[model samples]
Target: MSQEIQNISPIKQRILQFIAELGRSKREFYSLTGISRGTLESKTGITEDTLTKLFTAFPDLSPIWVFTGKGEKLQSQQNETSPLFTVNENIEDKLLNIIAQKDSEIKALAEEIGKLKQEIIQLKELLLK
Candidate 1:
């Protein structure tokens, strides 16, 4: 209910919210939903194509809620199943992924710095008589 979420169309907001709930990468969402990265960004409401793709990927989700802003967000589960991923697990997984990427970036930067330092030493030696 922040200003940003309130500004966009309701359906788009729900889709984005669902994406965060899924704890999956945008790349994965695009692959599964068959919608491109900017599809939600540009669209205000659900289209037939988007609805079909969304439902196909997420059968548990409530299309009525996503499309019309009516009813529960999820389809009622007769079997009383757990969510696809626990909220804590989703957050933990995202944090871990971020840490891994940052670690890799730091390593690459360290290697580059070492190379630059060595080049500086070599240049200094060459300039010294």
Candidate 2:
């Protein structure tokens, strides 16, 4: 609702609105959007890559509304009933969930790797002593 947000591109404003609707903080917005925290905070306008990521992550969101603010915030109810749309939505949700799980796994692995590296350094120091 700030003037800065209002002055930015419509897409960015819509993104902000979407995040607000979800009742998420900036940190959670970054997590949900899979956008880097620094980039989200620093960029005044949304990039094509970020937009693509946003749409891909939330298929139920209507791009028309996000880009032009002319349609419903969500996809039309007619599309929701279609078998193909439902299947695509299901696939996207599953994919996003899988990506989130993988990210957590990757973070845990990175921490373990760092610990192992430190232990190896300590062991090497002891051996030389």
Candidate 3:
């Protein structure tokens, strides 16, 4: 673990531990949480917005456990045969959903940038007239 991860706040440490438990890379956690790379890696504390997104993106995660780290990582039943407790497919689905959302956001941003560029061109034309 890096010194930065070691020095992070309690909640952040929990988040880091969660990430480690999942065996996911930092990039994967940032993608899943919709948290920016800089904020995810550099911040000492986890913001509410990031926490909200994290829970929303991964509903299987136990918020209580994430906040306090005193209980099971998941809130579902302990039985391995239970669908509620299954990990692999559910995690993959959640990650896919997050990736889809990011794709949509990127598309929207691209469209907005195109509109802004057109407006800039129109303003330039008016100014040059």
Candidate 4:
């Protein structure tokens, strides 16, 4: 509710503040939303094509909320059984695979470090003789 935003139309204000919060340039918003310049221009009452370009460029927004503000701030829906929840299953599996691999690596490294420490201790004992 800053003074600058208070004066503008609500839709344009939401778009502008959302962009600023996302910490990205307008060009990035254009790429993210895939929204046409004309579409954005018609909705926000912003005459500058560059203004509309902001929506498409930013990645973190839910296009639904950005376009109509009718849903959650993010793209997630309310229904617990929505298919969208499973949309990233493959990506999640890949991440778990990577984490498992890293865990194995860490276990091996810890074992090696233990062996090295024992060797150091034996060497120190020899020196003490």
Candidate 5:
């Protein structure tokens, strides 16, 4: 029930801070960022894959800060600005859940697209016969 992460590395600590500042839930962070809760909690250091997932999920987050504790927390023309999207605290969990759901939907759609592409190729081959 607690969002508290144990055995967290500094980078992971910063990641938790970023997620907190975003007004998002740990489930949402895990779902959208593709970083498992276990990995974030247990890993002692950041990896290229972790950084990629983090940056991809939250482009506004400053890589420099995530990596070296330097620069603003956000990256923009004026870095002092707030998060791009604001969620009502009452509905924050719901909205994040929806985001996670959407991510799953997108992945499913991508797989469907790949299947469709294969079907199309087969159809073309049949037509050529």
Candidate 6:
């Protein structure tokens, strides 16, 4: 929001404080959100409106906890008692899908190679006849 932050809106101030409390930097937030500098600037400037927009855009974000500083850091309530943050479960699913596709491709290539080898052997025998 505001460069000095003194001129920042309430919502922007809370967001800034949340980032600080989370031990995260602006660059890290930028990478996660993929929002442009101009959009972020404009959004932060309109703190009240931006809070709703941001929460709507990032449902997984814990806006109340982030702003009020009273609850968990994460948006979604997690059941796991693990202290460390982990990668999203979807990542594992995506990796498994890719491995399966690659395995199928490998099997098809092996079959084609086997057919080519048989053809080469047959041609060699015909020529030697």
Q: Give each model a TM-score.
A: 0.50, 0.53, 0.53, 0.34, 0.52, 0.36
Cα distance off (Å), candidate 3, residue 38 = 3.4
Q: How does model 3 fare in lDDT? A: 0.79
Q: Candidate 5, residues 43-78: lDDT per residue as tens digits? A: 477788888998998888888888788888888733
Candidate 1 positional error at 60, Å: 1.4
* Residue 110 lDDT (model 3): 100
Residue 127 CA displacement from its true place in model 3, Å: 85
Candidate 2's displacement at residue 100, Å, is 46
Candidate 2 Cα outliers beyond 4 Å, as residue runs: 38-44, 76-129
Candidate 2, 1-108: lDDT as tens digits: 376565667677777788889888878878877887855444466688888778888898888888888768888542543332334467778777778879999999
| Model 5: CA > 4 A from native | 1-6, 77-129
Residue 17 of model 4, lDDT score: 61
Report lDDT (Cα) of residue 52, candidate 4: 44
Prediction 2 TM-score vs. true: 0.53
In model 2, the Cα lDDT at residue 115 comes to 100
How far off is residue 117 in model 5, in Å? 66
Model 3: residue 29 alpha-carbon error in angstroms: 1.7
lDDT by residue for model 3 over 1-129, one digit each (tens)?
578776677777787777888899979888877887866566566788988888988898888788777767887843455343335567778778778879999999999999999999999999999
State how far residue 41 of model 2 sits from its true place (Å).
Answer: 5.2
Error of 5 at 30 (Å): 0.7
